[model samples]
Target: MTINETLIEKKFSNDLTEAELLEFKKLYETDDAFKQEVDFLKNVQRVSETEDDALFRNQLATYETEISPKKVFLNSKWIKPFSAIAAIFIITISISLFMNKDINNDSLFSSYFEPSKNVSAPIVRSEKDEHLTNRAFIAYSEADYQQATSLFQKAFEQTGNSELLLYEGNALLAMDKVTEAIEVFKTHLTYSDALTNRTHWYLALAYVKSDQLDKAKQELTIYIDSEEKFKKTEAKSLLKKLK
Candidate 1:
C-alpha cells in the first residue's frame, strides 16, 4: 500500500505507529505541497457527511461553470462525472466556508499579528548610559517580554512617554497576554501621540486574538480609515477575513 493509504488506514483505526506519526508530522510541516494535499483530502473527507444532495449539485454545477475544462485530481487519480463533481463540490464548499466563517479568528490573528519594531530606542547605547527606556527596549528586542513590560511601564511612569505604552502592549502581546495587551493599547491611544494610529491597528489585532470580533472590526475600521499607511493593506485583508 502507498504511504498515504497506510497512514490514513492506521489513523482511522487509532493505531498509527510512532514512526508513522513522526513521518506525518515531518511531511505536514516541511512540505508545503504535501500539507496542502493533506488538507484538501481532509476537507473532501468531510464532504461525505454532507446530506444536502440538491445543494451539493447546485454548488458543483456553479463550480463546473466557473472552471469547466480544468481536470480535477484526487489521491493521484483522475476522476470524471460525479466523482469530479464531488471533488469540485467540496472545493467550492471549502472556499465558501473559509470566506464566511468566524471560526478563523485565531488563524487570522496568527497570520496578521506582527510585533512593531523598536523605534522607541536604539539597542546600541554606551555601556554607562543605562536609561530606563534603553533598557526596556533592549529587553523587548531580546524577547524578554515579562521584563520588557515591567520596564516599559516604569519608564512610562518616570518619563511620561506615552510611546512606552505601545511597546508594553506589544510585549504583552508577545507573551499572549491578550487582555493586558488590549488595555495597554487602549490606554496608549488616549494620548495624542504619533503612535495613536499604529496603536489602533495593534488594538484591533489584540481584539481579534481575544475573539472579540465586534471590537476587532470596529478598531480595524478605525485603523483602515486612518492615514497610517504602514499596515493598511494587511488591515484591509484581515478585515475582509473577519467578515
Candidate 2:
C-alpha cells in the first residue's frame, strides 16, 4: 500500500519482512513531507480521543438521568416549566460558582498549582520545542500516555528533533497504535544521528507487535551488538521473547 494509505489504515503495526521494514525506513528518510503529515495525523488522533472522552462522559450522564424513574415526574406538564426554569437557574449558578471558585480556590490550590519550584528550569531552553519535550518526558515517566502524546506532537513540530520523535513513537505505542508506532520508530531509524541501539530496540518491539518474528530477531541481534550496556541486556531479553 501507498505510504499515505498505510498510515490511514494504521497498517504500520502489521508484520513486515526485514526488507519491507528497511524499505519503509528509507522512504521515511527521503520523504520529509510524508513525515510531517504523519506527525500531524497522530496529533489529530490525540486531540480527537480527548474530545471523544469528554463527549462520552456527557452522553453517559444524560443517558443515566433520562432513563431514571425520577425524571418522569419532571416531564409532567405541571412540573415541566418549573423544572426547565430551575434547570436554567442551576446552570447559571453553576457557571457563577465555577468562575468564583477559581478566585476563591487560588490560595487553596496554590501549593498544588505551583510550578516545580524546587526543580530549576533548564537554562538555554528552546522555547516551545523544549517546553513540550520536557512536558512529554514528565508525562511519560508518570505513565500519563495521553498528555505525553499531545506534548510530544507539539515538541516534534517545534524542533523536529529525534528525541521528540522517539517519545512520540513511544506515546503512540502506549495508545496501542502499534502500526503507527512502528512507522514512527522506523522514521527515527532514518536519522543518521539517532541513538542506534535504542532505535533498534523500539523497532524490534514494533516488529513483535506485528508478529514478524524473523525481523524482530534480526533487530534484536543488531541491538545486542551495540556498545550500550543496558540496551544490550534489553535486546537479549527481547530475543528470548521472540524465541
Candidate 3:
C-alpha cells in the first residue's frame, strides 16, 4: 500500500509504528488532500460506532447504490480500490455534513483533552515511599483525582514547587473542574518553571472545555507559536477549527 493508505489504516487501528507515526504527522501537516481524507475517515469511524449505527448503515447502503463506478482518488499518490469507492463516497458526504454543522466545542474538547502523565514526580512502588509528593503522584497515577488534587495543593504549598500546580491543574481538568484547572494552570504559569509551556497547553484545553472560545484561541495560538513541540500540531488543528 502507499503511504497514504498505509498510514490511514494504521491510524484507525492504533498500530502505527514510530516511523509510520512520523510519516502520518508529516502528511497530515503538509498534504491537504491526505489530511482531509484522514479526517473524513475519522468521521466515518465515529458515526459507525454511535447509537444511530443502523440508520447510518442504511444511509451508507443508499449512498453506495448511488455512487458511480468511477474510482475514488484520495490523493495524487493514492487511488482507492474499486470496492472501497462506496465507502469513500460516504466519507466525503460525512465530511460535508460535519463542515456544514456548527462547531461542537464539547465534542472538540472530548476529542483532544488527554491528561498529561505524571512526569513531574515519577512514582515508584516502595514501602519507604512516605513523602507527601510521592503519595500525591501515586494518587494521580491511580486515577484518584480528588485525593490527588488535594495532595498536590498541599505539596505545592509545603514545598513551593510550582510544578505541582501543573499536576494539580491536570487532576482538576481530569475531574472536569475546568475553572479550577484554569486557575491552577495560570498559577503554574506565574512561576519561572520549565513546565510553563505545558501549563499553557492545559490552560488552553480548560478554556475549550468551558466554551471560552476567545481564551481558548489565544492560549492555543500561544502554544502553536511557542518552541514547545508537545501537541503543537494538535494545537494548530484545534485553532483552525475554532476559527
Count of residue pairs whose backbone atoms collide, per candidate: 0, 2, 0
Question: On residues 1-243, what C-alpha lDDT tens digit does candidate 1 reach at each position?
Answer: 568656654554457899998887887888888688767656555554443455555565566557853532222121223444466766899998876554577678888887799876668657897788998988888889999999999999999999889889999998999999999999998998878789989999999887788999999899999999979999999888878
Q: What is the C-alpha RMSD of each candidate to the true structure, in Å?
A: 14.5, 30.1, 18.5
> How would you encode candidate 3's per-residue C-alpha lDDT over 1-243 as one tens digit per residue?
576887887777677999999999999999999999988766655544433334544554555456843533233112222224455576889998765442576688889988788767668788887788999999899999999999988888899998899889999999989899999899888897878898878898888888788998999888888899988888999899889
- What TM-score would each prediction reach against the true structure? 0.58, 0.44, 0.57
Model 3, position 78: C-alpha lDDT score: 22
CA lDDT scores, all candidates in order: 0.78, 0.59, 0.79
Expressed as tens digits, the lDDT of each residue in 1-243 for candidate 2 is 465545433423455567766666666678788667656645544443323334444444565477774543222222323333344566789999877755443322222211111121232334455466677777776777788778878877887776666766777766767788788788878885535357677777666665666887897888788775645665686577557
> What is the alpha-carbon lDDT of model 1 when measured against the actual structure?
0.78
Q: What's model 1's lDDT at 13?
A: 48
Model 3, residue 117: what's the lDDT? 84
Q: Which candidate leads the pack in TM-score? A: 1
